[model samples]
Target: MKKKQWQGWGPGEQAEQHYLVEPRALAGGGDIRHVSEFLRACGWRDRSKPGGPLLMDSLDRSIRIAYDPFVHPGGWTIHGKATAHQEEWTAILGRQAPVEIVAGLTDALTRPRSAHAPNVWAPLQEQRWHTPPGAGHVTAVSPDGLAWMQFHQDPGGHAMWWSGAQDQQGNGWTAQFTATTPMHLVQSYAAALASPEPVMRPRGRVPHSARIRTTSVSVLPSQLSAWKQARVTAARAATSARNSWKTNRPRTTAHPHAQRGVRAHR
Candidate 1:
């Protein structure tokens, strides 16, 4: 079967440009709007005023989302408190993490799930992420065998999974997701990471961090044009949807972040 790929881009160092297909999960790409707009579409209310932190919540108030650039590694912080109907969960995406990858987690939050819906380790296992016999952790080694990802089943203190990688030059990065985050979301993330899709990046900025595993290729003019068109189409659709939503929803406190055109990874 053909593999699904995640799309993303990164900066480069070379004057003569080329495309590097890397996993956005590790390289980090996409804009903040990818998250914010999707939330709005799912009936999340924006509660931030002008010049304040971006804050939003689900209609039922079980999930809360915050984006404060002032915070270290500022990206999107999501919290789900146990309510009469749901269990507690927490997820954090660093400022540089891929919005698409994070979307998998967010999208999972909007739906109903059972405890036995799916195993988080399934996708990773398909991609060769493994747990040693009698071991409590699962791991996937990169193609080059120098980088890896790991998940701890009983990591304690809410911490469930985390991964890190570094290049020979010593640059590196690490990411973690908390327990109770929903296995479906974790499965979505793992599936994307294990996907064969080539995340596009500039040759100069090929390795955004040490953990990225990619092969460099010269971008065809056709690919660039296609990418541009897809972006334009998506932007127009989002704008139209947002406009329709604003017209129908009851008025709430004004929020400027919901209206800003700022791109996430510009």
Candidate 2:
């Protein structure tokens, strides 16, 4: 099959191509604003200092988010501490990873939930990724052999899952999460990685690592711009709605009788 040329984003900084149904190979961290807005809505307070990494902490201080572009491997990190009755875990959605894909993990991490373990490999399996027989480590690789995901069971250390994608030129990126990371969060990542939706990128801006394997179709700049704008609009709308509710919500007052404690119930 004849593949289209990767039209680097043009001189106007417009999108040059759209990779259909792939995100792991997409260059750069995705729309991080979505992540920041989402965390803020979840009551995560931004503690980032000027010109530093975007650092945020949960209300109860059990979770933290760190997004640093300047540092390698520091990328987007979600750390969950073991409370008095809980265990600690960490997930790193690498710097080169797409923002939209990584946000799935963050969304799952922040949402309240009960404990449950879904088969994390189910998504990959359903997507037709293959696992080698008799492999010591659990792993699955895309049919094209360009992408692979795996989980390592380490008894003496943190059991972890990591996934990556690359081109023929040996350029690629990976994401990692510990076994203690919630199954749902892991599943969310698995699902996103297995998704068939194509990711849009400026043809010119494609990272060196993805160049060889990246075959993209040139798309209208507006197509990419509109997509980006839609996402921002949605996030802003959600924030506005939340703020409006907070502002317009009726406040409840304590009953005077209740305040009196009903004679101490003696």
Candidate 3:
């Protein structure tokens, strides 16, 4: 069977350039013997026609076999640490490994290794979120991996929003929202509204229900931290109050005289 191969390119390269391999040929390649042994241990079979030596068609094909040059000497050090932790959990739980075990394993495997860990799987810390000035909300949508669309809420409050999606075509369209009117009427009115010179008066007047304006503000890191701390303090106070209320309820209900006094106040 043909093996899958991945190609990588570095700076100043016009085209992608790399090599290929297949598992059977690694037995003769000195450094690749370790990989061949690992595969054999994993019970991989050739599964070709019986009574013939497994023949890898080409050197290119033979070299396409499993090899991860990116792995460090510690052998995915973060993964090793995580697996060790998981073994501890398995030992403690002892034969009650639920579906959560699989989920925990996946989390361990996928979590970021370190602040400056080399990213072999995907781009590192590239995704970002930012709200535009005077906009109520901003969201990013990516259809292809390369490009993204930023949708912004219209601050003018015409009950409309705007977004621009770029394609291969150079010229893109700008869409604006106008009051719902017949297309012909809208066109004729729009034409009339258009200035013959620089300054022109309105041909017909249209009434709007209300005018809307948005205020934009910038928040500092200290302000944001303060706000978060305030919220946490408020939440803790609320929880304490709730617990106090719960504790007091038994005493209030148990004592007839206290209940009577409370009822009289109500």
Candidate 4:
């Protein structure tokens, strides 16, 4: 059987330029939408057959959902050391992993050889939740790797909430309180809203100093230490990996028929 490849781009695009490395499960790939193809990779769909019902009742079996998820007050650029994953029940489904696996995964996540330990999870206000300044139903696989969830909102209601959590290694999960609705109205409205935006000309040039200003953000010393430690661990791991590769490389011996130098020895 052919190996499945998880890709954000198709035949014409490159992943580096397009993808923001995802968090926590450790594979590097971009977010998936129109996941019919992704479903194929996961063996959720039969590749030889056409796609089937993508209905809500069909999804809830695996997702364990909740309605009216809470929205964060504002955009939060929170940076800190990677925090431990709590085995607490989810607000939506009250979902919790088994103690042993959860603990094992937690330790592995916080183990010695990791870096990039920031976790970002702030939901923008509803007005800006699903457009350019907002995120659409941010998609992710379930913790059990069984189903996909779209943490998005609808026109008449806030359909779902999605929050992303990641470890220092860019291993991440986008947890969601998802719901499905008849999206025809939303689709139509979006189509109408897709018209060209009005062009606005600036009245005059503002003074340079007023227009731009230098700013500094204060970070906790603990956060700084954590960030630095993560980097150090990553660097050491890279060096060790290089050494191992050199040690294990196949030896290149002299050719059997190669010419030999004639020298006299005392």
Per-candidate alpha-carbon RMSD to the true structure: 13.7, 6.0, 29.1, 23.7
Query: In model 1, where is the ten-residue run with the lowest total lDDT?
Result: 6-15
lDDT of 1: 0.63
- Candidate 2 segments whose C-alpha is farther than 4 A from its true place: 1-24, 41-43, 114-117, 155-158, 209-266
What is the lDDT of every predicted structure here? Answer: 0.63, 0.72, 0.26, 0.28
lDDT of 4 by residue, 1-266 (tens): 44344433245432221111111122211111212222222223221222422211111122111111123321111011222432222222111111111122112222233343321111122112233323355543323332233456677886654433333433333333223311221222222112122111111211122212222233333444465466446645654675688799887875544423222221
lDDT of 1 by residue, 32-96 (tens): 56667666766678998798888989877888888777777676778888976557877766665
Candidate order, TM-score descending = 2, 1, 4, 3
Between candidates 1 and 4, name the one with more favorable lDDT: 1
What is the lDDT for 19 in model 3? 22
> What TM-score would candidate 3 get against the native?
0.17
Predicted structure 2, TM vs. truth: 0.70
> Which residue pairs overlap in candidate 3's backbone?
20-63, 20-64, 21-62, 21-63, 21-64, 21-65, 22-61, 22-62, 22-63, 22-64
Q: Which is superior by lDDT, 2 or 4?
A: 2
Error of model 4, residue 47, in angstroms? 62
Stretches > 4 Å off in candidate 3: 1-212, 250-266
TM-score of candidate 1 relative to the true fold = 0.61
The TM-score leader among the candidates is 2
